[model samples]
Target: MQATLMIYDGTAAPDSEIPRTGGVPLAPEGFIWPLCGDCCGGPMQFFAHLPVEYGVLSVFLCQNNPGSCESWDATAGANRVFLFPPAGLVAVAVPESGVTLLPAVSAIKTQVVTLEPETGDDDELPPDAYDLARSGWEREPGEWFGKQREVLGSLGGSPSYLEDDRLPGCPSCSGTTEFAAHLEEGIDRQTAMNLGGQLGYVFVCRPCSEGAFLTD
Candidate 1:
């Protein structure tokens, strides 16, 4: 059967400056296949590993939000799964707090484990590191999702929300919040899991900010 062959050259890194030629080989059936899509039919990029740090994290702007885009905040609502190069599908359910670390290959080389699921022996994951999500639909409904366009609209896209001295303008009132506090309490690291773990983003207004430890 005379059929055009499709192939993906993973080794051959294509240059961004280089343009594709129409004469290039086209495979009738591509080497790779579609993975997942949003409800609005927008493509979703399933990543291979989770980001250890928050800044370099991968974000999926959901093209399926009704009348708006649903940008799943990785730390807030993303369903993280380790993608295998060979396996067609595998899942690693994560905590609602997001992934802490990509576990090194060990007993979980092939199978994906659900979050905090009691395996009786508890050999699935270590006591300290983070776990991933098995599926997007399996995420907790507590993710406070709002109108994507409206959320960005309130922020003015400052491009420096996380930067030092800059604050992520609140979407509720579109008000600029001051740097509140870093929690000097000695129990911060001691009871990390108790007080919502660690204090990450704690913004407050004039009254709220002053109400905190003003001695500093």
Candidate 2:
């Protein structure tokens, strides 16, 4: 299988139009920063700004009182994902209170890697291709361990290890949402968006211009 990995490039301007994590989000005029509805009832932390085939996927998760909120649940109000149009986007105004942004703006670049299918007994569960590709990212021989820090996540691939029942339906049309991207905390924990050390999943409904966020 072929997987497109999102490799960490370096620091970037917070409002730059690019694939990145932990930057201020770019949105259309009159956009309101989302508030966490599950717990703490504060502004959600901006997690990523990804440009996709249909539009830009802007993700957010609750950081204040993290464990108390269900940010990992797609239907929960603690986390949010938005599919915004490609043009006429400007940096959103930051909220004065609550955890609303990450400490760093990390940029991303893509690398396509070919994965070999796992050869296992028929009774065994199939391996997650995206996980295999991510665990296998290496800058050089014997550097796999260290190089993994540069892997932010991936785009346009099936949700890794995600169950069929967990797939989110479009909130508007009740149609199945397509897997959009995978999100990692980041290279530095201090600047990373907390996911309870788990992987994050993004889903979208292009026709409805809506999206969902969850973690596992």
Candidate 3:
């Protein structure tokens, strides 16, 4: 039988997967956010937009909450929402319940990032696994932040989704992680830095915290 939803390389999902909730900005607005991914009561704000080859990702975090509920989940239509752990991955939702782990549509990413009147029918990426896990299959590094959905995808003609405010664990290890920029003025020179202090409440792994440079 054909799967109801088709998961892309855990990256691109169909346009239909995006939640069409009105009155909601691309990001959650004025949300008191009493619960973090770990269910901690705190304020989670708009973080960042991860522009992948397939879609624009949105990630959120709450420093106040330990790892209790720093996760994110939204329903656009009949499809469930989630985020892939690897750099590029996407997947479609399947039948699931309290104890049953649902299966996914696709696994690898087509690395396709274009949705217009045309070019929509051109490219596609097979479901790419970051690693492998139980259920229909999962990316590697099993210990994922329970706060966020394991994987999510974007299909043509669907609202885009992505990873945002991703806390940098070790840029040296992860390569390039996005950060809020800050400009510092010196008598003879100016310097650009990563915002860490005031923005500390944002997203940054434990190590990145040591190398953070606050913004103005």
Candidate 4:
């Protein structure tokens, strides 16, 4: 299998039309910033701005009260993912209260990575190919532990180690959603969107123009 890895490429303007994390989200006219519906009921923090083949995915999660918000659940109101038209998107107006945006805008660049599933004993389950590939991303040979910060996430690939029952159903159509991307926290913990130390998953229902987010 193969995956398109999103690599950290430094800072960018908050409203630039580029694939990135921690930037002001761009949305179509009349789009409002999403509020957390699980706990605290405050505004959700903007996480990523990803441009895909069909549209732009604007993701958000609650940081106002992290663990208590159940941000890892696909059906939880604490997190959200929106798919908007590729054009006519403008920087959304930030709300005056609560956590609304990430502290830094980290730009992204893509690199295609080839992944091969590990072969193990018949009784021993192999590690996820995507997870294995992600963990092994290195800038140079034998420098295994130093370059993990450069791996922002991946563009297209199967969910890493996610169970079948956890696949999210679209709220609009009540149909299974397709895997869109995988998200890592970021280069710096202080500036990264909190995921409770879990990898984030993004799913979309193109026909209905809806998206879902979860973590594992």
**TM-score of every model?**
0.18, 0.93, 0.20, 0.93
Which residue pairs collide, candidate 2?
none
**Candidate 3 residue-wise lDDT at 172:** 34
Alpha-carbon error at 133 in model 3, in Å?
35
Best by lDDT: 2
Model 1 clash pairs are 5-27, 6-27, 92-132, 93-132, 93-133, 93-134, 94-131, 94-132, 94-133, 192-197
Candidate 4, residues 39-127, lDDT tens digits: the string is 77898999999999899999998888778898889897888888999999999899999988898999999888787777888998666
lDDT of 3 by residue, 46-87 (tens): 222233333333333333322333232221011111122223
Return the candidate ranking by lDDT, descending.
2, 4, 3, 1
lDDT of model 3 at position 203: 20
Instruction: Provide backbone clash counts, one per model.
Output: 10, 0, 43, 0
lDDT of 1 by residue, 7-53 (tens): 11121111111111111111122223222232344333221111111
CA deviation > 4 Å runs, candidate 2 = 139-146
Candidate lDDT scores, in order, read 0.22, 0.88, 0.25, 0.86
